[model samples]
Target: MPRPGSHKYDIKRSRLRNELDDAGIPDKRADELANEILRNPRGLRARLTHVARRFVPRPGRRGT
Candidate 1:
């Protein structure tokens, strides 16, 4: 469990929350995600993607 009362932890958590929010996650969900990420032993070792977007060619167009 993380020490939510610590000032440093709070500051970091808030920063993570803001990043998540900018990533298009809802405020509530972002808070949850931040908590989970903070609990990781490696501390954000891997990139997280709630939804991955890819570039798709147009229906009738293809790379020449």
Candidate 2:
């Protein structure tokens, strides 16, 4: 069986992606950022900052 903490990583990452999506980020960009963070979670703060810089509001600025 997996250790207790084994699933934590997945759970945290999923939450991060969901937050980004809920905040109007695109799925493709969110996935890419999530993958990068997973690969180097040690500097997550910096990574997230970088990802934040990449986001640009959608052209129409309208919600679904």
Please name the candidate that would achieve the greatest TM-score relative to the true structure. Answer: 1
Which runs in model 2 stand beyond 4 Å of their true positions? 1-6, 56-64
- Cα lDDT listed for each candidate: 0.70, 0.69
The stretch of ten residues in a row with the least summed lDDT in candidate 1 is 49-58
* Per-residue lDDT of candidate 1, residues 1-64 (tens digit): 4577688888889998998888677889889878888777464655363222222244687733
Best candidate, lDDT = 1
Residues 1-64, model 2: lDDT tens digits: 2222468767766877888887667998776676567767688899777665566545777534
lDDT of 1 at 3: 79
Q: lDDT at 52 for candidate 1?
A: 23
51: Cα error in model 1, Å: 5.7
Model 1's lDDT to the true fold? 0.70
